[model samples]
Target: MEENFKMVAKTLFGFEEILAKELLQLGAQKIEKGVRSVSFYGDKGFMYKANLGLRTAIKILKPIHAFSVHNENDLYNAIYKMPWENYLSPKGTLAIDATVHSPLFKHSLFIAQKTKDAIVDKFRNTTGQRPNVDLKFPDIKINIHIDRHQCTVSLDASGESLHKRGYKTATNIAPINEVLAAGMILLSGWDGQCDFMDPMCGSGTILIEAAMIACNIPPNLMRKEFAFERWQDWDVDLFEKIEASLLNKTRDFHYKITGYDKAPSAIAKARENIKYARLEDFVHVQHEDFFKTRKGGHQKLHMVFNPPYGERLNIDMQDFYKNIGDTLKQNYPGTDAWFITSNLDALKHVGLRPSRKIQLYNAKLEARLVKYVMYEGSKKQKYMK
Candidate 1:
């Protein structure tokens, strides 16, 4: 029988609860939610499943050591004592990623460098051969996290952030992160019971994520590789079994998933990405201005999108947001409109009071995920005026 061990799944700022719920649904035990991470207990197979199946997680880490360190020397000595040969070979490659919140360590890079020195020095002193650093692709990736006076060293289980879902071969100027898109869709409570649309589907990330959620498809199934694949204890047979198990659980989606973009280039890129995800059968993309379009059918529609926030684009954001409200009220009744934007000023011009507002962040920009419920029939008329 496999033994259960502790693992942490790191996520964006506002996704801790959503990620905890996802972990519970995935059969994790002793689940505890932190600020931007969740800790749980699971075996090796469960770890593989978490990396492959978790939609809201950005990366998973397996902690190997923890200690108190107030200075660089203490940090170096603590790391040097670890048995590195168990995880990496003397001739292999390695990479170190560090995050520090201590007054002692102001620079994360220096801490990473100090960690690398300790590991390499230990190898060189023992076998006269040390591992080389490979930032892009490494055999063993180490993570150092220092909070105040305590430090924890972990092995990164997912490489290159799980947001690199291997589906988006093309992107627009400001493409939404895949994990954020999935988290938004899940937070909006869209269970795929109705039609889904991304009115301003820049690169079709929301649409692709929605389709994956609707069908119960694992988001990382198409990913090229995970850091665990390079570990010494990697079990190809066990990984294959986990993959087959996840694939077998994918259910059929019944409703339609659609996308729209004003730019022809965006439409083309979205189409390319959707095809690459093999979600063309469930998603449709078109080159149409969302403000000039209307709801196609009477089915209860669920909308989620990442609209431009005037950061890079030179346009009148106030007028653009007004148009969004006008189109939703006049054309798209019986819909639940939800979107994320960092432009709080432009959000007021939407001209509709949101039923729910959740604070979030978009790449360091303070943002909000607002939901405006447009009721059907006469109730919709009240909000229209």
Candidate 2:
């Protein structure tokens, strides 16, 4: 029988609950949600399944050791004491990523360097050879997380952050992050039952993510590689079996998923990315400015988008936000419009009150996911909800 180990699935902020629910659905036990992460228990095969199946997760980490530390030398000594040979060979490659929120150690990079030094020193002292560092493509990726004085060292089982679903080959000036896009669509509770749209779509990220969710597709099926592919006990046959099982679970999709971008260049890039995801058939991208277009049909439209947030603060974001509200109220009735933006100062200009507002983060900037409900008529532009 395979052994069950603890694994942590990391995700973006505001996705912890959805990720926890996803873990529960994947047969993971002892599911626990944390801020921007979810912890669960699973075996090697379960780890493979989690990496292959979970759409909302950024990476799955398997913790190997935990200890108290207040100094750099303590961190290095603890790392050196671990059985590094059990995971990788002297000829193989390794990568270390450190995240620290400790008053004792303020620099994350310094901690990563110390951890790497410890691992290399252990190998050199024991076998006179050390594994090389390969940042882009490493055989094993290690995660060093320090919260206060306690540190947890774990093996990163999902490489490339899982957001690189190997689908996007092209992008525009403001293409949304895949993981964030997926989480937002899921949070909006849109399945394949109704029509969907990304009115101001920059590069069709929301559209592509919606199609995958609607079809019950494995988000990482198009991905080229995962960290487990380089593990010592990597079983290709087991992986294939897992992949086939996930493929078998994909259900049929029966809704129209569409996207529109004002710029012709953005439309072209969205088309290219959709093609790369092999979902061109399920999604349609067109060059159309959201403000100029009206609702195509009476069908309830599920809309999700990330409009331009003036990072330079040059444009009058207040006016752009007001336009967004005006366009939805006047043109897109009988629809639910949801979008994320970091421009809080401009939110007040939207005029229409949001029925639901959730706090989120876009990189370093604090953001909000706001929803406005449009009725079936133009005269009553105010949100019904």
Highest TM-score model number: 1
- Stretches of model 2 off by over 4 angstroms after superposition: 312-314, 378-385
The global C-alpha lDDT for each of the candidates, from Candidate 1 onward, is: 0.95, 0.89
Q: List the residue pairs that clash in candidate 1.
A: none
Angstrom error at residue 202, model 1: 1.2
Residue 179 C-alpha lDDT in model 1: 96
Query: Number of clashing pairs, model 2?
Result: 1
The sequence of per-residue lDDT tens digits that candidate 1 reaches over residues 148-187 is 9999999999988999999998999979999999999999
Error of 2 at 147 (Å): 1.5
For candidate 2, the 10 contiguous residues with the lowest summed lDDT are 376-385
- Those runs of model 1 whose alpha carbons end farther than 4 Å from true positions after fitting are 380-385
The candidate scoring highest on lDDT is 1
| Residue-by-residue lDDT tens digits, candidate 2, 1-385 | 8899999999999999999998998899999999999999999989999998888899999999999997998999999999999999988899999999999998898998999999999999999999999999999999999999899999999988888888887887756788999999989888778999998777778888899888888888888888989999898888899889988988787778888988898898889888888887789988888879899878899999998889733677988999999999888888999999998878899999899999988877889999998988653454553
Query: How many collisions per candidate?
Result: 0, 1
